[model samples]
Target: MCGKGQLVTDLESGEIACNKCGLVSSDRLQENRAEWRTFDSESNDRSRVGSPTSLAYHDMGLATVIGKANKDSSGRQLDPSMNSRIQRLRTWDFRTKAHSSTHRNLLHAFNELGRLKDKLSLSDAIMEKTAYVYRKAQEKRLVRGRSTSSILAAAIYAACREMQASRTLRDVANATNVKRKAISRSYRILVLELDIKVPLVDPMKCIAKIAN
Candidate 1:
């Protein structure tokens, strides 16, 4: 090891290396900075401007919607004609976003997911996993001719199993107001089509859940 204090941090490789001996002192360092890229110092800094992209959202939280305000950039009220045109634009924007069947499906499914997340007090990780499972099932056309709520509930249960969360099918069914049998059937479909390896539930967790 080089005794020299000269260390070079490679941001791209996430490594801290000894400049003199070319030995890496650390690896897999996490970047805690804001997700903003600026090429020049003279450029305006736009760091931490928005929420991080997430799968829990139908549009992955990246799509923007026109504001309902009828005011211009300078806060001046728009003319009646202009206001009408803006309102029409807003309606079109909203419709275009969910125009496709897949988009409409996701919009509804994610809305249900949000409600269940609060009702079940599910963690972000579990919700994200649920979203991923639901997306995969949708892609495989397993959602066609099936109840969306049932498939979503099944996805939630599958996510809980994969994530080792102490949630039962009964819990999901109660939170989602879906029939347990439907959820079970949809879960089996997910396991078969997606080939997901669900982990066995811990008896201790089940006891703990019951005790609570």
Candidate 2:
């Protein structure tokens, strides 16, 4: 049946062939099965290299590059992988810097969204919906070429508005670290894009919450 830890002894050879369901190396197995060893000890040398299911939110602008900010001449502040990350961050920074302050803030907001990407487990369909909303908003001049977060905020707000999620603009602003004015402008852009009314939570959403 090949059950777990089922031991079989070779009658002719006198050596035992262990069919243990473990990570132990067959070579490490002593002649006497009584002398047991943990399999993971042998596997300690192996290591995983990359995060396939991960996405990085490059918020650190100039600080992104290897030796650009506070690193040594060799550009070895972080790891070789960080080079690509820094490059991506710088690229985004460059693209968004040309637009209005609100646009810049929106780009920064996208950085935060990048972090939540894997954590929130946003489905590809939902992400596509988010993208669709952004494109629609862009056509209306609500948002365009901004960081994904700002665009996302507007998209979610639009989606929530349609779905009546009851989530407010202030909530989006606080979560995105974007100014209310910036969000408002983008929201207006959103309204213009979709040609539909979105009930914004108003600037009061930015007011300090009372603590008892």
Candidate 3:
């Protein structure tokens, strides 16, 4: 970032960026569309909007959810038959969205990535990048017979490599409960299959990380 670092939006790619530095703040930002309205009521609830969509969810937070309650949306209690029907709807809705094998694999992998992010104190950007790498790997059929956690750890390691993050393989291996060899194998698979160009690690940052 430089100068005033004014925010800019890329219309084509939908990326939020800094105009001065050309740094993308977020690539998967949620779209916000507002239809103009005149609000004059005292109890006008404008701030109670729902959560923003997220890429981290298996469904990307786009799938509809039926809340577990005996009441309807207008706060009316349902009859016994209606209650069972709503419960079945909820169960089927969840199953319909979650039944994909790739989705389940990615869901588990992302959860593993989340735990590693917490343990290693990695930023959201790094986790997002790792997720991209993992998804790319899955797309290439590189995760067919491999451990999901191992592939996710390798994805995080590859992201750190690309970003020149000072984390070591031993560090990630310890934090992710995966073996160094497994991470290496998965990393190789990612490189060979995805044709990803993982940049060299910065020696100075590595030295500083070791000294710390």
Candidate 4:
């Protein structure tokens, strides 16, 4: 037991405990925060215990993923014919989840979002904002036939400008391996169609971002 200890909620068990030592001090842990969390102008609170809403997944981490295994739950292999059937089911199942054109676009864009989030070393807030803007663009039919990577690069670039995260179009273009012109075009579409009101980032911030 550490001498300095404080109450820390075990997010998994919902038990309040000491931070230094994992000792439960209270049975009831309050879920109420002093203020509501609005990450990047969006409140992504899907009502589900243990599984919080996250931008990392195409379906906001809510889609049920069927495991890909030939073996059954009992660890016994299914009949070859049955395995074939299951394989088809699995493929269709994945297809069904993102059946619509908008959903399909989101799927690919989210995947690219994950890649750029890591490559650019972006924060969770930026990632969330990027996903939000992309979703809005999809809803507005702004990403009708554009490449997923290009659209996603534009969204991330807009998010950086909206949140003043110090990322430029060129930075996002390089990170996503998309052309700057494509990103800029999609970005303009996003800005106009979605009516996104992004405040101008400071000139000093731009200079600092370029220097970095």
Query: What range of 10 consecutive residues in model 4 has the weakest lDDT sum?
Result: 29-38
Q: Give the Cα lDDT of each candidate.
A: 0.86, 0.50, 0.77, 0.75
Tell me each candidate's RMSD, in Å, in order: 8.9, 18.7, 6.4, 10.4
Highest lDDT model number: 1
Q: Report the candidate with higher lDDT, 2 versus 4.
A: 4
Clashes of each: 0, 5, 0, 0
Candidate 3 residue 152 Cα shift, in angstroms, is 1.0
Could you tell which candidate, 1 or 2, scores higher by TM-score? Answer: 1
Can you tell me which runs of candidate 2 are displaced by over 4 Å?
1-128, 139-149, 197-212
**TM-score of model number 1:** 0.78
Best first by TM-score, ranked: 1, 3, 4, 2
lDDT leaderboard ranking: 1, 3, 4, 2
Encode model 2's per-residue lDDT on 1-212: one tens digit a residue. 33557666422122345567533233221222122344577564543432222111222222223234734467657666766787777778666554665455435544555554454433333333444566455445544465445666777566556533444677667666777677767666666757766555434433532321
- State the displacement of the C-alpha of residue 143, model 4, in Å, after optimal TM-score superposition: 0.7
Give one digit per residue, the lDDT tens place, for model 4 in 1-212: 46599777533233567888877786543333233444444657634244556665678776776788789889998999999998898999877998876677777778777877667867666677788888877777777777777878888888888877777777787888889999888888888888889987779877865697
lDDT of 2 at 209: 29
Colliding residue pairs in candidate 1: none
Q: How does residue 22 of candidate 2 score in lDDT?
A: 36
Give the range where candidate 2 is weakest over 10 consecutive residues by summed lDDT: 51-60
